[model samples]
Target: MNIAFRNESLPDKLFTILNGLIITVLFVSVFYPIIYIVSASFSDSQAVVSGEVWLWPVRPTLEGYSAVFNYNQVWVGFKNSVIYTVAGTAINVGMTVLAAYPLSRKDFYGKNTFMILFMFTTMFTGGLIPNYLLVKQLGMLDSVWAMIIPGALTVWNVIIARTYFQMSIPDELLEAAQLDGCNDLQFVWKIVIRLSGPILAVITLYYAAANWNQYFNAMIYLKSQDLYPLQLVLKDILVKNDIDVAMLAGDPADAAKREALKTLLKYSLIVISTVPLLLFYPFVQKYLVKGVMVGSLKG
Candidate 1:
């Protein structure tokens, strides 16, 4: 084997060096906050409150995580969030695929009209009050269905999936399937879906991430604390600063302790809340860029 180097022009070499520098800066800008937050989460409460921790933990301790997990509702919220994210994402992807497959087919009647209808929704919608009333009328408020059913699909995702199918799935393949006695349903389930892994991964990531972070809908539609998602629970704990008076009353520095712990918990809570999605993303990240670019090509 032999190695060779193309003697690049001076201008090209300079451009390459500059591009590398820019990319490094961008990476650092994005990564630095995560490092700071993780370090702060593990540092002592006073250190976190005083901003003494930066790239590394100062007086490192697990007090913040202990306080956060000690709250009983944290587990409940975790369970509910898992349920919502998994169920909601499943519904979202299923609906998007069902809609996109038909629209991708040239022979599907009223495709243009359906496309217009879906696109029109992106531009306008029935007012919030009406949507609320509709949900209330349907008896979905304060239920798990309220979280999953209302947002089962997005118009933008439908368009992307449709574009991916149109561009990637060939008509000749469908024709070949038909000649082999494959029905449309069998073809979609067996062939189309099997080949559509990239698009599926992209949409699954989008839906799963959205569902995990859902808070506003839970705030509006839920009346029971037991049904609250992790975001809402975190809000009450971190943002609202709800704490037990019994625990605070005995100590002379209780007020200061509460404030310090609150500061510490903020960072720990963020790490806890985002850990699932952070873990999940790397598995699907390889497909994300390719899926998004190819899916968005025609539309």
Candidate 2:
């Protein structure tokens, strides 16, 4: 009925239909797993074990969540993870901005040398033993600083942010600001940062997600269970099957139900760990594509 469709050839119509079908199939492939996980988390443990859950929760119950919350370490791990994500993301974003701003400036000296050094680190790193010894020497072992300080800034993020600044903030704008008595620090704080929302959001999301999911660092550096992040605690449950059977079920003799409860707990923990990032992404979703695109562009 539309003018555009009216002019389309039969082959063009067929291609459009085929493309839509493929996209629909891909969407379902990605989306169905999320639905299944959520459904299984809420479903009765027996229903989950029996594979009764499909699109919706069957005989839905909160037992899995109840069991999760009842574990004191889960709460402690969650609290620690939140602290690490917030503090680490703040440091990461701040350091990235500082590094990127200087590197982005055309007049800055030795930027090429600094960029080469940065890229070199990405390709090669000090081995685990050396890294452990360094942390120990710094007195950061078994401390919260161990989690936040070691990976305070990411080099790849610095490059992305530098490119964003180069593409979006013209050199003429800097000259104009300087003429108006704006100092370098003031220009960065007021102008560059304020105008660089998309890239900032992109890097913030990246750093936040990384800090939240980090576990290997905690495993290596922290001796205290109190310092463990949510992901580490999840690793214990999912990989090692470390959950106590008595905590989930009142009757320890009920082996089948306990096994089912364990499976349900895994699903619940996954949902719990994932929900924060899922909630966080929507707030910055609008910026992600635009930021990645503009930041990728080079002179």
Candidate 3:
């Protein structure tokens, strides 16, 4: 009987071990690339270029970061990115919330028609050239307004918000507010808006990321390098071989430092650019969950 019992348990034990191995393999495969890049970023560039450093950083130093910060253009780009993200997100959220609320209500006249019109834009656009011409015609070309106005409201965001409001917010709640003599604007502002935390947060992340990463518009519309966003500036740095020698003014050993700094700058800028969103998401992640669930209730 003892022998038979041991035999019975052996198969299950083997299966458990196999399952653990599979999961471990999956985890490593997914995480190794991220780890490799992060490690490489800190390693000596010669080691990186010669394929000497693999999984671990060798000869790690802050020279890369020092180089990145030393560049005036990087700071200028960072400042512009901040401006665009804050302004763009504010306009995007305000427009999305206001537009979605009315469409969520069943009693609103011409809602269906308006929704169809909005949806139509999502499927079909006036093409890039036409849009560019229109912007120029409106005298928005080369101006900050060119960035902010053109992408203020996304139809997809509107649809999602409308869906959330429809499913999550109760009609009876709106009726109660109405009975208390609350106007449409007041009701939306006080009641519906309060409950829409998650969806709003998601929208905020989307809009902010879009604005922060945007470069093509700046490349085309703005002639001044001073007005260039971080991504575009980063592009110039990454691609350009002969950066201004004046940019490397600090230490006496500028030549050696510049090489190491270039590699470090690549890593530092990536970290700096990505850190804001990582920090931002944790604070608003709970709201994103709530907003999506609530706002998507009807859509």
Candidate 4:
């Protein structure tokens, strides 16, 4: 028998069973929605509209995906969203690393004061109108810069990265690097970055997800439809009911079929928008727990 299993008391076994049950329930709760969306996306419009879909697609069809891809603006919005996510995530990770490295240093003067100021911004902000004025003054209105610059780096991410660096990077490593004639820049570039992969991945995922899903900033600042991100385009289709009748394949005169197709389109769009993050997540997931736990648990 396993040593751990042999040592378990009756109460411990009961607790383990309860914990497993709770976890299974939670997993199903989260997982069922994803399965439903995917099944509905592939399901025939009538099946979806009639509430026939359950664990699997009742009547499988690609009609929803077909309608979604046929829309020209969907492609434009997807391209723009990719651009924003990549460029914005790069700037975010770079700024976060730069800010975090210095703050992590014990010898750095006024770090506490700087940290306090950073924390202060998190608690209170200039609010929407003032932020809009600031963005307008900076000439970012209705431009790509509006999406990328205003929210370049999150202060909370900085704190997490800072905590991670403090906990993980030993003082002796820096001293050794200095003795080897490596300057601060070289040391950070060569050693700190190499060892800080987990934290970097964690923050990169954070920034990428934020940038990808963001539509509020685009809605507020961008007036041109050409600059719209995928989320904004989806908003127009789903919430504003902006779908064009020409995109539907069946007779445009049929009101009921059109409505059903529209409902199906919603599910398709959701899966399309969500797929990239789902694909990207697995690559960084191994790093996530270690990075988050080390930073949070130790400090």
Candidate 5:
């Protein structure tokens, strides 16, 4: 061991200690909350309410899930949420990509002027009432389009994507494509798109998450109970405590079982609502990070 050379110029002993401390602190900060939630979700409701399930579950139960799923409305809400997420995200990504591409190019005429127009919206708005009135006048007040159409072009995403294009995509490639008789559409599809993996991932994640967790638009624009998203349904359940007592257990005769089931379903809602994002995030996380970097820096 004494034969090993020390790179003393790198600064060793104190640096190693500090690095360990920082990493430990970061890890605990992130992991503890997740652990607490998971434990609380499984614990008995009274135990959870009394704060006995702080670090780990006590009197573990699954009633919360039974309470949540037994309701036919919850399933319908889940289906509506899925539909909204899929359709809304598709619209968002398509518009964002199309809009971002041309704006990314320095040679494009009036690009700065166009960028200013977009940025201006981010700083100010026409106010909520006017926007609501416009939506109502346009006959989109009670439709899914109310959610998707209103947010189709996010200025932040557009700017990020444009930045990504400028930084991550080389100008020489565009020139070479043009020399080969490639048109704008072909260049965008064949050349620019192929190099945009990280940015695409980031955009997809943003749209998907936003669409998935959305509720306010549904609440404001939709009057139909069947069209309510999962979040809205969850809010009704939580704020109103409107769970049907009959479906709260396998049999209504047992009060203890029903109480336990209600507790489990409350926790189950948290787990269920979060599951999709958790599953989806890992698939695109690598691309997401790269996309953010690509879009942030100016050429």
Candidate 6:
């Protein structure tokens, strides 16, 4: 029974078919790499190296995962990463809000001058060596502040947040808050922030991701391995191949066991590093999308 309504236009049908094919191709291109990585991570190193792993694992094994879990430094890196993400994100968000709110205010004096100074920083800088020297002079090197203080606020985030405040938070609300004897801090805390979920989520995700993925800063500033973030740890494991060969060595079947293990470890490292963000994204997905829209559009 073909009871469903259909527009009997040939062009429309052709367009629909073309669109679906293009979307399918795009999805496959995006998703296939992820599937391949997962499969290769689970597959035996030999199978992975021989290009046997495809959409599914070939000669499935847990050696890669076992290596990642058994490594003690991975845990230390994970802990440090969590700390950096939480603390750095807090500093970033707080500084961004403090900067943005003043700029958003119509009565704010010298906002243009301040904005120009901030934007000027985005275009020009003292370069990396000078920045490093400044951090050293400030005694932030090899310390937690090295991660947070240097990148306390982002200019782009400030602009987005300022725009969001101007467009989203009504002046009438501020006036009402003032009428009710609310001070600037009180109004910001009680009214402005409460109304700004989308932008907050957007910025939080941005800062958190940046902190979590930060390795270059830590690599340059921090000397102690204890202070190393997950990204730095990952760089060691994947790029440097800092793995113990005690177990993988002397295996009867595999001659290049250590090299094979390194290949497997690469995939496992990627999955372990990525899983946290995958879990975190779903909770804030709606807000993130809305925030991007609000930040992108001008009112």
Among all candidates shown, the one with the greatest lDDT: 4
lDDT of each: 0.87, 0.91, 0.79, 0.92, 0.81, 0.86
Q: Give the deviation of candidate 4 from the true structure as CA RMSD.
A: 2.6
Q: Which parts of model 5 are misplaced by more than 4 Å?
A: 1-26, 44-54, 58-61, 250-260
Better of 5 and 6 by lDDT: 6
Per-residue lDDT of candidate 4, residues 99-170 (tens digit): 989999999999989989898998999899999999999999999999999999998899888988888899
Residue-level lDDT for 26 in candidate 6: 100
Q: Write the per-residue lDDT of candidate 2 for residues 29-81, one digit (tens) a residue.
A: 99999999999999999999998999999999998888888877888999999
Error of 3 at 251 (Å): 7.4
What lDDT score goes with residue 138 in model 6? Answer: 97
Q: Which candidate leads in TM-score?
A: 2
Per-candidate RMSD vs. true structure? 3.1, 1.9, 4.2, 2.6, 3.3, 2.4
Q: What is the TM-score of each candidate against the true structure?
A: 0.90, 0.94, 0.85, 0.92, 0.86, 0.92
Q: What does candidate 6's lDDT look like per residue over 122-156, in tens digits?
A: 89999999999999999999999998889898888
Candidate 1 residue-wise lDDT at 180: 97
User: Which is the winner by TM-score between candidate 4 and candidate 5?
Assistant: 4
In terms of lDDT, model 4 sits at 0.92
Clash number for every model? Answer: 0, 0, 13, 0, 5, 0
- Ranked by TM-score, the better of candidates 2 and 4 is 2
Considering lDDT, where higher is better, how would the candidates rank from best to worst?
Answer: 4, 2, 1, 6, 5, 3
Question: Per-residue CA lDDT of candidate 1, range 137-214, in tens?
Answer: 999999999999999998888888888889889999999999999999999999988999988998899999999998
**Per-residue lDDT of 1-299 in model 5, one digit per residue for the tens?**
23232544346656866898999999999999888878888777778766688798888876566666677788898898898888888888878878899998889999888888988998999987898888899999878778678877788888888888887788988888899999999988888878888787788889888888877778888888887888888888766777777656577887776665676677778887899889988888777667667656743
